[model samples]
Target: MIGSLLYLTASRPNIMFSVFLCARFQADPKESHLTAVKRIFRYLLGTQGLGIWYPRHSTSFKIVGFSDSDFAGCKVDRKSTSGTCQFIG
Candidate 1:
């Protein structure tokens, strides 16, 4: 479930953080994790028509990229995660 949601986040920035938070618990998912997943699903259901849009007449597609991560943002198991993206100018 979470995997599918994460995949959708590529075009749905609004749910990125929430999905990331829930993903940290996949090692040993608990009831709280399940609830968070439900919340994400409800959110998607309520915003089904929502989506990303890029203007067809935008300027030259100059690209920029950045990334950063904490070794253990989640205090549970000390696993790390990274976020990166290329932005157009």
Candidate 2:
């Protein structure tokens, strides 16, 4: 199930964070993790119309990216967490 969700993340960036969070427990997933994955599937089913779109023709384009990190954000491993996003227009 995690594998399928990871593959979908390529086109459905909105679910990337939640999917990856649930994936972290793949080695020893609990009941809660299964519940979370089910919630993500439900979200995708309801949001089928939402997605990123790219124009086929354009005279010019601009790309922008933003990223942030938190120091020692992970309670289990005491490791930093970071995320990034890119926008094109």
Candidate 3:
């Protein structure tokens, strides 16, 4: 399931964080982790129309990116998690 979700993240970037979070417990997942994964699936099902689209023809191209990170956000390993996204227009 984690592998499938990771593949889907290539197009559905919105669920990347949730999917990766759930993946951390793959070796010893608890009931709550299972519930979280289920919730992510439901979210994807309901948001099927949401995704990035690129046009074939364009005169001008612009690139934009944003990134953020937290300090020691992970309770289990006390590691910071960071995320980044880019857009082209």
Q: Model 3: residues >4 Å from true position, as ranges?
A: 52-89
lDDT of each: 0.88, 0.92, 0.89
lDDT of 3 by residue, 1-89 (tens): 78989999998878899999999999999999989988988998998887666766866867799999999999999999899998887
User: Whose lDDT is greatest here?
Assistant: 2
Question: Mind sharing the TM-score for model 1?
Answer: 0.56
Error of 2 at 60 (Å): 13
**Model 2 lDDT on a 0 to 1 scale:** 0.92
Better of 1 and 3 by lDDT: 3
Cα lDDT for residue 47, candidate 3: 89
Residue-level lDDT for 22 in candidate 2: 97
Q: List, residue by residue over 19-88, the lDDT tens digit for candidate 1.
A: 9999999999999999999999998899988655567776775568999888888888989998898786
Model 2, 3: alpha-carbon shift in Å? 0.1
Residue 23 miss distance in model 3 (angstroms): 0.7
